[model samples]
Target: MYAVFKRELMGLLNSLMAYITIGVFLLATGLLLWFFPDTSILEYGYAELTGFFSLAPFLFMFLIPAITMRSFAEERREGTYVLLAIRPVTDWQIILAKYFACLVLVVFALIPTLIYYYTIYQLGLPQGNIDGGAVTGSYIGLLLLGSAFVAVGIFTSSLSKNQVVAFALSVFICFIAYSGFDAVSQLFVLSYFETVFLSLSVNEHYQSISRGVLDTRDLIYFITFVALFLIATKAVTGGRKW
Candidate 1:
């Protein structure tokens, strides 16, 4: 698993895809937080990244899929799935190794954002009046959200041999999972079910946790969501042998 993880990580660095994804993330966030005049982070006097955090999950609708689209799709396209199938590793190991590698890449991409925190710290009126709890909570929420998206991307990548299709499907699925429930909640026909629907929406739970509240229900929801997708991916891969 570690070998597979290292190989996958190294492969990402060798391609332009990783660079482009990271660059785009930084560029988009930087522009919103620093460059843009009206809604810039500086203009809001937000020592934390509430604005940036709010925009990240939406931006990741494209970025996470771009990073994960080729995970297994490219392998299958290259006719290497058969070769990988015969390896000593179990199918779950292979899937998880690849998933972990993608998660590592996502985490690495987020590391640079810490500089924004430091910058805000230095610029704050009290030289650090920032809400540390809120910032920490936001970062945790981002990781949970990104992990769920990564799992969704991996499952979609496992379903097809074409990377482009994988990317599109992954993005669509992530967007739906992230926001579909809230949309359902707004339907007049589902008025009675609004509470349940809203409870299921990823954005709802993310917002709760991002406020630094640390709700157990929200944490459980994210954990369950990730596990469900990972298990689904395992089942899909296992079916290949039958």
Candidate 2:
């Protein structure tokens, strides 16, 4: 598992794809938060980084899948997955290694965005006047959301050998998991079941956690779904052995 983790991480770090993905995420977010007139902080006349947190989720939906699309898909396509199976790594460990590898890259991409926080901290009216607690909570929620997405991407990657197909499927699954429940809730007027379905969606949990309140149920939602996807990926790989 360690070998798998190291190799996967190294592979990404050494490749242009990792740099490109990270660059695109940062550049795109920066443009939206600091450059785009309507969404820019200069235009908002506030020190808060609310726009960044609000916009990041949408960008991560595509960025994560692009990063993880090759985890298992390329391996199987190139006939390396069978080689991986013959090694001593257990199924879950293998899936987890790939999951963590992709997640670490996601984290790396996020680290650079801390500059935005620092800039906002200094630019506040009273200096460091920003909503520190809310910002911290939002960052944590975003990281958790990204982790769940990594699991979804890995699961989709394990489903097929075509990278494009894997990318599309992962994005679709992530979108549904992240927002589809809320979308569905709007179709029905029943408040009771609508709330239930919204609770099942990732956005509901993410938004709850982002409000500077750490609800046990919200954390559990993310962990449970991430585990579900990872387990599903393990099952897929175990049966295929490819």
CA RMSD, predictions in order: 1.6, 1.0
Runs in model 2 deviating more than 4 A are: none
Q: In order, how many clashes per candidate?
A: 0, 0
Against the true structure, whose TM-score is highest?
2
Compared with the true structure, all predictions reach lDDT values of: 0.89, 0.91
Least lDDT summed over 10 consecutive residues: which range in candidate 1? 183-192
lDDT of 1: 0.89
Tens digit per residue, CA lDDT, model 1, 1-242: 77777888888878799889989999999999998987697788667778889999998889899999999899888987788788788888888888888888899889999998999999988899788898999999999999999999999998999999999999999988889988988884546699888888999999998898899999999999989998999988789744
> How close to the true structure is residue 109 of candidate 2, measured as C-alpha lDDT?
91
Query: Model 2 clash tally?
Result: 0
Q: Model 1: how far is 24 from its true place, Å?
A: 0.6
